[model samples]
Target: MTALPDDLARALDDALDRVPASRLAPVVERLIGDYRGGVATVSSRQGPILRTDDDAAAYAAYRMPATYAAVHDGLSRAAEVVGRLAPRTLLDVGGGTGAAVWAASRLWPSLRAATVLEGSEPVIALGRRLATGADDAAVRAARWERTQLGAATTLPEADLITVSYVLGELPEPVRETLVDEAAARASTVAVFEPGTPAGYRRILAVRERLIAAGMGVAAPCPHDGACPITGDDWCHFAARVDRTSRHRSLKGGTLSHEDEKFAYVVATRAPGQHADNRVLRHPLQRKGLVTLRLCTGDGAIADRPVPRSRREHYRAARDTGWGDAWPPP
Candidate 1:
C-alpha cells in the first residue's frame, strides 16, 4: 500500500548522482537483463554484484525501488493477518540497501531498534549511508553488520525477522540451515522472493520448513495443509508501483508503472484466527455473476460462483481482491 518513502528516494537519487554515467549505464543494463530473466548473476560462483561504489549505486538504482515495493506489500499482508502488533526490535537478513528495514519500519512505526546483516561492505556502507537519511528514528539509527549468513550462523532474537530477495543465491543445503536458524530466533518470520517459479518454489520450501518447526502461516495461505497448488501453476502475488522517469529510462519501458510480482510467506509462532480461504486470483465478474478461485483450508482449490441473486455472496466476491482471504473484513 505504501510507495517508496520520500527520504529513501532522495538518498537513492544522491547515490545515483555520485555514479559516473559511463559506469552506471552498463550496470543498469546488465541489472535490467538479470532482473527480467529472474537470473541470480550475483549469487553465482563470482559472488555478489555490489563490489564497488558504482556497483552498489547501479544496483540500488535499478532494483531497490521494486524490491521495496514487493516487501512493503508482503509485510502489509502479514500485519493484516497477524493483527497489528508492532515489534520493538526487527532484524533484516541480507538487508541490501536496508530496503526491508525501511519497509518494516514504515509498516510498524513502533519499532525502536533495527539491525541489518549483509556480507558486502560496499553494500553495508551504501545501506548505512542511505539509512541515515530515513525519517524514522529507528531506521536512521539501525545497526548495519557485515557478516556471512550460513547454516552455522546464529541469528539474534527479535519479534519479527524479514528475509527478502536473498534465498535464490544460496545452495539448498545452506538455505535449509538458514531457515532453521531464522525460525529458531524469531516469533514471526517473513520471506519474499521474485515471482518466478523458482522463487515460488523457494518460498514454498521455507513455508513447509517453518510449519514443521511449529510455526503457523499468517498470510497468503489459509492453512498448513500441503499446498493445494500443483502442476505448472505457482503461488504468487503482484504489487504495482509508479515508475520514476529514471526507472523507465533504465528499464527501457514506456509504461508509467510496473507490477512487481513476488512470492512470500509470513509465518508466526502463534496463528491468528481469520478467514479459511485465500482468493487465488482477481474475481472474475461477468453478467451478474462473480467467480472466485480459492485455496481453501480443506487443502483444495475451489471455484465458487456467486450470482446476483445471492446478494451477500455476490457482494463479497465482487469486492474481494486478489490475495485477500475470503470473508475478510
Candidate 2:
C-alpha cells in the first residue's frame, strides 16, 4: 500500500472542503455509471466524463487517491528493477487532476519539469489549482494543457510518460496510436487501468505494441516474451488507499480504506534488470508450508511451496505479498 504524501493529502483535503459533498455525490454517482458503462464516443449523446467544475471536483475527490496509489506502486516496482531512474522531465497524457504527476514526483525527486495533457478544461483548471499547493516545485510549476488525445495527437518528448486510468475512455485505434506515440516520445512509459478483464486485455495489447516498438519492459512482467497466465485469470495488482473524510462522504462508504485493483506495464527504451519471478497471488500459508504462485522469467506460471525446513527461504516467502518479486528481490 502506498500513501499519498502529507502535503499532497492536505492539498486534496483543502480542495475538497470548497465543494459540498452533497452536490458532488450525485455527480460522483453519474461518473461511476459513466465509467462502469464505458464512456461514449465523442460524437455520442453522452459526451465526455468531466463536463463541469463539480464533475471535475467529484472525479478528483473520488479517484485521485486510488490513481495515485496505483501509479506509485507501478513506479516503485519499476524503480526496483530499473534502478536510479533520474528522470528530469515527465509527460502525463490524459492526466486528469495531475494524480500521476504527484506519483511520479514522489518516486523520482529528480523530476525538474512536468506537463499534463488533459482533454477537459475543468479538469486542467482543477488540477492546476491543486498543484499550486504542492511542496514539489516540479509539480507546482507543471504545465497543464488541454489537448484532445487522438490518433493525430503528437506527444512531446520526455524522460518519462505516464498514462493512468485513461485508455478505457478511448477507442481501440486511438489507444494503439497513443501508446505507440508514448513509446516513441519517452524513454520510460508507465500505463495503468482498472483491474477488470477488459483492462487486462488492454494492457496485454499495450505490452505487445511496446515490445514491437523495440521497448523493453521494466516491471510487472519479468520477461517481455509473452504473458503466460492464460484462461480466465487476468494480470492485475491491488493498491490500498486510505480514504479521506470527503472521499468516504462522496463515495458513501463506511470503510476507512479501499483497495484499487489495477493493471499496469512499465516499459523503458533501454533494457534493465528484471525480477526472476513475479508473485501472481497472495501467498497461502498453511501449517509449515507456504504456497506461492509466480510468473517466472521463462514465461511460465508455477506454484512453488516453501517449507519451514528452509528457514531463510520460508521466512522470505511468508513475508512476500501479492505482486511482490519472489526471493525478496
Candidate 3:
C-alpha cells in the first residue's frame, strides 16, 4: 500500500530500518517542537508558519514527516514535468526548503540554472546550503535569496518558471504579478496546487490571463467551463513521488498517504505550443461503456473534475468551445 517511487521507498526503508520507527517518531516530535520554538525554521518564503513557539504551521500544514524524503520526491516529480515543458533555465519563485530546486537540479542535461526567489530567513539559510552543493557539479550555479516576489527582483529570460504550492498564501495582486513575470520571460509557466476549489480557482485565473496573452493550455485543460466537482466539494488527482535521498526519514517505515494529490496548470507561452503531448483519440473501450460528466447550474461546464455523467462532459466541452477539437478527443 505504499505510493513512494523507487528512490523514496528505499530511503524511507533505510531510515526506518536504522532508527526504530517507534523511537524516530519521538525524535521527530522533539525536532518539530524545536522547529516551532525558533531553533529551526522550515524556510518558507512566506512568514513563519511556525514561529519561536513549539508549534510550526509549516509542518502542521504538511502533516510534518519525521524526515523530508517525501517532500523531495514531490519536488523531483514536479521538476521533471516542468523541465520537459521548458527545459533550460528555470526560475523557482517562492522556493522554500530548496527541495524543488534540488529536484530541478537532477534533470540531467535538461536543467541549466535554477534561481530561487525566497523571502524568509530560515528558508534562505537552508536554500544556501542546497544551492551551494548544487553549484559544485551543476552545469549552472544555483542561487538563493531573501527577496519578495513583488520586489524589483527581475529574472533573466528562462525556459520554465515554476510556482508550486506557494501562491495561495499571497494576495491576489501578488499572484497576478507572478503570472506576469512568468509570462514575461519563460516560454511556459506551471502553477501547481493542492486539489482544492481554491487551487482550481487560482489555476483558472492563471490560465485565463496566460491564454489572453496568446498563451495556450499545456496540462489539465479542464475543458469544462465550470467545476466538475459536485456538492460544493473540490477536485484532486494523485502523483507519485520518487525520492532521491531524504525519502525514508520523512515517509517513515511505511507510506500512509499516497502520492501528493494536487492540481497543476502547465500553460505554454506561445499559442501553438499546445499542440504537444497528444495522441490520436479513439472510441471508448468496453463496448457499452458509459461515461458521465458534470454540469453547472447554468448548464455550463465545470472545471472541477468529479465523477459524473457524459452530461457533465457535454456541459464542460460546450462551454469551453472544446468541440472535439484538434489535437485529440
The estimated TM-scores of all candidates read 0.94, 0.97, 0.59
For TM-score, the strongest prediction is 2
Query: Candidate 3: minimum summed lDDT over ten consecutive residues — where?
Result: 275-284
Which residue pairs collide in model 2, if any?
A: none
The residue pairs in collision within model 1 are: none
| CA lDDT, candidate 3, residue 179 | 86
lDDT of 2 by residue, 102-147 (tens): 9999888899999999989999989999999899999999999989
lDDT of 2: 0.90
State model 3's lDDT.
Answer: 0.49
Model 1 global lDDT (CA atoms, 0 to 1): 0.84
Clashes of each: 0, 0, 25
What is candidate 1's lDDT per residue for 14-121, written digit by digit as tens? 777777666787888876666566456335436665678777788788789888999888777777777755788999988888888898898898899999989989
Q: How many pairs of residues collide in model 2?
A: 0
